[model samples]
Target chain A: MDEVYLFVTKKILFNLVSRPVAWFDRHIVDGFMNLIARVIERSAYMIKGFQSGRIQQYGYVFVSGTIVLVIIFIYIW
Target chain B: MNILSLFVLIPVLTCIGIVFTKNMKQTRLVSAIGMSIQLILAGLLVYLYLAERQAGNMAEMLFTYDALWFPTLNIHYTVGVDGISVAMIALTGIVVFAGIFASWKMEFLSREFFISLILLATGVFGFFISLDLFTMFLFYEIAVIPMYLLIGIWGSGPKEYSAMKLTLMLMGGSALLMVGLLGIYFYSAPDGGQLTWNLLEISKINIPIEMQRFLFPFTFIGFGILGALFPFHTWSPDGHASAPTAVSMLHAGVLMKLGGYGAFRVAIFLMPEAAQEQAWIFLILTSISVVYGAFGAIWQKDLKYINAYSSVSHCGLVLFAVLMMNQTAFNGAIIQMISHGLMTALFFALIGMIYGRTHTRMINEMGGLMKVMPFLGVVYVIAGLASLGLPGLSGFVAEMTIFFGAYQHTDTFHRILTIMATTSIVVTAVYILRVVGILLLGPIKNDHFLHLDDAKWYERLSTITLVVAIAAIGIAPLWLSDMINVSLAPIVNKISMAGFEFTSLF
Candidate 1:
């Protein structure tokens, strides 16, 4: 009885419930932060594409923004 | 002259006083005295405002003074203070006073620096008090124009590039704002009575729905960019990373606030139907700002850039709460503004002092600073805790109120967005703690770090003033909330009424 009980508790319960749970907990928590950080880093790359330090690029952006506003007001609205 | 006019006058006079000073000593001394006087006057104004409120003066604006400036265009120099404006003025006074001391050791063209700084303050004070859209815009430009010289002349790390970029982006925002303001002015009287730029007068008239729809975004986004709305927020991190200490303090602390205040006062208050119709779009944008800025701070190595990104996040929260458009949320928004102004000023002042001592801003390059410079290290920790929304801190109080108010909406969109924004608290804690652990704790990584001295008298004075204000709000938020709550009544009523009408249309 003791051998059977020990086998079930240690092997089945620990492996099925405790081990995977621990693995899941560690990976999920760590992975969530890393995933978000990765997403942000990727978005930042897109941001840097336009944040180019050139004056002409910034001007283009400004003019394009105004044009978009004009389109929104005149055409869409 | 109305006492409200003195807010602008004192700073102008300070600029004049700073001009005659020949050396750094005299220049800093004069600037300090003038700002100290301004701080005292601000305190007096708050007391008087409270006294008037106690005596049951439920007027919309107190201490108003009006004079015609352009008769044909119907422009006026109008000034007044509601509770919100008074709180903002007080914030400007405190930050400016602390900022003078933060830059006490500036020796390179010290007189010119002090002059430009005071001139910027004059613009901020003027902007807060102005009741007319024309003068308000004038003051807004006045506040913005000084950054070009302040940063380019005294800044570091591609100063010219940063200055030009900041100026051009803000100028773009201003151009948008100019169009929006003119639209409002022209539409001030649809029945074709005499046109006016006075805010109170304009609030009484209902602008046509189509015109409101057209102009609302222009105004909101114009101010939104300065408030560090995402995408356009690219200017802020670079500008802050390069500017001098006091300039960063004032710019981040008070100047960015102008965007939030103007959006609340003019854009939303005046165009309620449009704001109600369009709240979701800006709400999404502001949510992006809050979260994106927090994540952006995590990847930064430079100290100022981190704080600057964090400022974008906090200021974004201010706009987010404003869009909630309820009394509780509006109260939270104003408190958040004041709280952020104090907290960020404290962070920058401490960062400036640390950088001054170590001569480097990269967190990875330093360690175990608490052993050598215990004062700054401890203050930095407190600031970090505040940023992370620890209980009994200003950040916690402001954020709680904002989220609580937002939860009142009971709609799926608001609920989801609120949850999205709430995740930023976790991200904020991550970056703040990561920086604190790497920068202030652990073994000293450099042998020379042992020689570092703690905060000087002026540095201590600057940081302490801001910390006290932060703690005061954190501990007893009721009075401040009450003041803001009462003032938010008119704006909230307008929005709710507009909401009712919109539902009826549906």
Candidate 2:
């Protein structure tokens, strides 16, 4: 029974240390992969939106704003 | 110390006066009187130029004014005039006067428009007069910036977009030009001994061949964008399409010529060897502009677009003439500049009248315009004939001289390109005839066009002035050609000194 107790104690100790390390490895990798997939998906969606003319108004606004900024800079500088 | 500053300062002062004027009529009258005085002064300058030329004394520099503007940078407010500059000044005077008359009916923002117009003329006049690169650039930018406001505030049909595109493209070109100018300035002034932007002083310094090769394209293409060289020419048709009639006349008529003039005076003249080496490339691209712009106009529905593209094509011939790098071609270039100016101005003026009455630019919508406006129809046909290089018109003499000059070059490939450009003359005839046939010959289609009246007295007066000038140049080109040849002699000698032989064919 003492041997059995020793063996159970050793096993619990091993699990306590390795389980956290293993969990960390798995979750960390999965989180990284999920972040990459999210980024790629968002980029693809943005490109699709651009091709479908949904982004034109935004583009014009951005361009006009940029031009205004440039003109202001030129005027000031 | 010279009369040249008055060309710029007078208009600027008048524009300032216009700001204080109470009513539109007063503004118009003041602008007209100011321009008339300028015109007379320009005429006197031309007389001086001719008198100098006649006495076989081309070496004497007349009306030189110099003062230090930026001492640290060696930039001076230097102004001078030679024969070619005097002719260009005269051209500006005629166009400005006629443009003022053309815009006499403007009720909306009339004062503002005249102010910008006069300011633009001032810049152009200043550019032609200034002998210093920095001063010239200042005037160049001033001339170009007002175009955006003029077109945006008082224009039609997508004017804002056109204005923005034109301003951006031209300014982008100027960026390249600025880089080139600074590069030349620094390289030529390596000793750091009073860095100078004077054209004559810079020309005296022999720029390294390698550096010339690198900087040549920057300056040429940069200026070529304004000259409507092939790929950078897209802005022109759209800009001219949306511009007010007077703006279109001045912009396409004289402003575009400034580009060619700049390329000639600065790029080619400064780096003759580089220009010689790159002549083939310019020839190819300009040939394409000539042919493509003509065919492009044939497919256009709007009358303004047609004229716009034709200006592109006609201006291409000017670049092509410059690329030929011969005295005859150079003479042809000057003539083409003058001829195209008159022709395009007449075109815009006529188009404006029709648009004023019908409120549409689409040729398909209006027919039998000649039935209502016989006088306009005659002038329109004459202008069209001149544009297509008909034998009796100014375009014919210009194109023939260019071709003859280009043939003297040993490059068989360039000769073929010149031949291909000649085909555009035929294409121009096709499109011009097609436009006249569809609009003037067919049965009246739109009932709305029936109420259109003949041109008013002022319109007739302006049109007649251009028509007379076109006819005068076409019939007796020697009067202008002699002056152009006198100016081209120095350019040819400079190029020859760079080891490119320019043998006259005529």
Which candidate has the highest TM-score of all? Answer: 1
Model 1 is docked with a DockQ of 0.03
lDDT of candidate 2 over A28-60, digit per residue (tens)? 632453465579789998888555556778898
lDDT of 1 by residue, B215-255 (tens): 99999999998999865777788799899999999999999
Q: What is the Å distance of residue B137 in model 2 from its true position?
A: 0.7
What's the distance in Å from true for residue B166, model 1?
0.6
lDDT of each: 0.89, 0.84
Q: Is the docking of candidate 2 incorrect, acceptable, medium or high quality?
A: incorrect
Task: Please provide, for model 2 over B374-422, each residue's C-alpha lDDT reduced to its tens digit, 9 standing for 90 to 100.
Answer: 8988899999999888877888888888888877876779778988988
List candidate 1 stretches off by more than 4 Å.
A1-77, B500-506
What clash count does candidate 1 reach?
0
